[model samples]
Target: MEIDYSTIKVIGFDADDTLWVNETYFREAELEFAKLLSGFETPNKIDQELFKKEIGNLPLYGYGIKAFTLSMVECALELSNYTLPNATIEKILNIGKNMLNKPVELLDGVEEVLEQLSKKYRLILATKGDLLDQERKLEKSGLTTYFHHIEVLSDKQNANYSKLLNHLDINPSEFLMVGNSLKSDVLPLVNIKAKAIHVPFHNTWAHEMVTQKETSGKKYETINTLRDLLKMV
Candidate 1:
């Protein structure tokens, strides 16, 4: 189970929950969204339906707050049998706007870890989300300088990672990815013969979750915080 770090040349980082507070805000927005539609369905039902809608809409919208807001609006209309009011629709839009405007809050030791590691290995950001929103966060993050490359992927799959590694001319054995989602961050890299470290965030979107069966033979390291990465690399 020992992962050799001596061969790693390029380190990829997942942006959202790994470097900053992302899912926590989404959780808060979900609560607010549920409250807005409480008259149509209970909060629990709304949450379940919303998650279903998100999964169903993934191909069309991809990941990001805009897609989530659109899904929320669609769920509201469907739950109310298309009788949802304009006022409620407006409230949902406002919720998305609020999230977009919220300040970027970096997770503990994010900058320090990035700063320290950048001095050695080449750093790249391997994250997936809406391009505009991801660009906005990177701009606000103030940690942009540490990264040598930034990729905003439409999805994180083995093929996607292969393409990225190929584009960067990096060998799988010499690459490592760090992130919070096992499905997006760890499994894909492991499948591609690369190293991955899982830094779990307290809250994760339902869509990004994976069963133990899916990760059964995946080889990766799990760290409690970004600060712990300083010791690894």
Candidate 2:
């Protein structure tokens, strides 16, 4: 669907898979760590335990490879009768460290569109992630300057979206939520009467995926790439 960009004041974007690659490293690390502990437990069982820990501890630790590593290592140790030693801890820690150091690869045409759009509208970086990890990724990705406000949210609930819109001096009708997840980015904005453009991404973390209700209640725009958003907004 087409949008009149003239009416859209602030264009919001999700950071991780929306702009640059993330979550892949976490998946990779989990698989490798599971292999390392294969003697103790199956990967499926280990992943189940890790998923449980992630869901139950959502209030404690939001997101990051560090937490994932800790949870996996802790659960593995418990499951395996503490077979993992100090050396194992170091190994896991190094994996997370390597993830941090991995090159920041922005998705195709992210810069071109953001650069094009920034000149016209008030741009905001609206993303939910582990605060430290999120900030570092933004800095490294070289797209921070395009945004007037950068909000690092814990989660994108309706309350979170409402507070953010108010803080930016923008109303729901004037906002356009652009991101990958319908659960976090698109649907939450829809709850508040904000227009949203959903650009789907592969490899959605279990926590971020949501059921797609067939009814079209609010203004919903779906596209394949970040660059294509230019056509609508």
Candidate 3:
């Protein structure tokens, strides 16, 4: 389907995988976490339990490395039946720290796409994670000047996007969001009658994965790379 971008006055970008590398580090950390707890459970079981812990903690802790660290620490204690060594707990904490300190690696063509699109439309960084960490990544990214606004949301649901558009004085029909997660970036905007474009990253978190049924009737466009934006919009 050919969609029109004529009414799109503002564009929102998802920070993590959409702009730079994110989920890859989480995958690495999970492996490290599994190895640390291998004595208590098989790697597969450790992975499954850790995912449950992260999802269960979402309501209280929200998203980001800090929350993931806490979940890993808790998982360790439980998996070891409260006999987990203090040293191992420390290792898990270090995992989160190392992830936070990882250098911000921008995706291919990110700067070029952002530079070109910023000229014709208002761009905003619409991402969800620990506020400080997200802010840190943006500062390190050196692409801050390209965005008109930056939002660190608690979650990316329809209501969240609706509130963001209202606060920015932008009509839903006049906004377009581009990102890697269909669950967060695309569906929410489509539900709010806004435009969305999916620019998928190679890796995705299990929690962000959506069923085909959910997206079967959703209206959005998918592009293979960020560079495609310049030609589309």
Candidate 4:
């Protein structure tokens, strides 16, 4: 699976861990409740319970911070069963605010790689999560000029990928999906008969960590840093 970088038109990037730090904020939120909530529930349990409750409500509110924060707040209230005070809700809100305030700390060499890549390929940003949060980070990072299109989807499934390809009017064989999540980025691209480069992140959110066979990993190329992508792309 050799590629001529010159022929690659659109390079789609995953936002969270691939470009900047994300999971740290989520961890920080859980840690904020460790002292008070740990007596009643483990940190992992708290996150899982919140996530489970959120999943059930996703159909109603959809995705983004409005929904995510609401889910977190709702979960906290549910587990505490009105026993939690106003201060607890305030604490969760503060944590959510902090998560929203995360700076766009791009990974090492991300800017340089994107700058160079922009000269050759039509870069596109394809991310899922809060649209406003994503936009704010992108603006602060000043990476918007490099991208021709910015796509913030509610979720990245096979249908999302297929629809994107159709909208772009590009064949799957001509596209390359680059991101940190193997489940969301690499395998999904491979499933669509497209190529993907997995750039592993040091910190993977519990929900995003992926496990696949060595054979499955073969279709995907791995790189330690975004700069390493130059070798293939």
Give one clash count per candidate, in the order shown. 0, 0, 0, 0
Ranking by TM-score: 3, 1, 2, 4
Q: How well is each residue in 98-194 modelled by candidate 4, as lDDT tens digits?
A: 7787777888998999999899888889998878888998898888999998999878888899999899887888888899988788887888878
Please write out the lDDT profile of model 1 over residues 1-233, one tens digit for every residue.
Answer: 68889999999999999999999999999999999888889999999999999999999999999999999999999999999999989999999999999899999999999998999999999999899999999999998999999999999999999999999999999999999999999999999999999999999888889999999978999999999998888
- Show where candidate 1 strays beyond 4 Å: none
lDDT of 3 by residue, 1-233 (tens): 79999998899999999999999999999999998988889999999999999999999999999999999999999999999988888899999999999999999999999998988899999999999999999999999999999999999999999999999999999999999999999999999999999999999999999999999989999999999988888
- The window of 10 residues in a row where model 1 has the poorest summed lDDT is 1-10
TM-score of 4: 0.90
TM-score of each: 0.98, 0.93, 0.99, 0.90
C-alpha-based local distance difference test score of model 1: 0.94
Candidate 2, RMSD to the unseen true structure = 1.8
Clashing pairs in 3: none
Stretches of candidate 4 above 4 Å error?
1-7, 62-64, 213-218
Residue 43, model 4: lDDT of 80
The stretch of ten residues in a row with the least summed lDDT in candidate 2 is: 210-219
Worst ten in a row by lDDT for model 4? 209-218
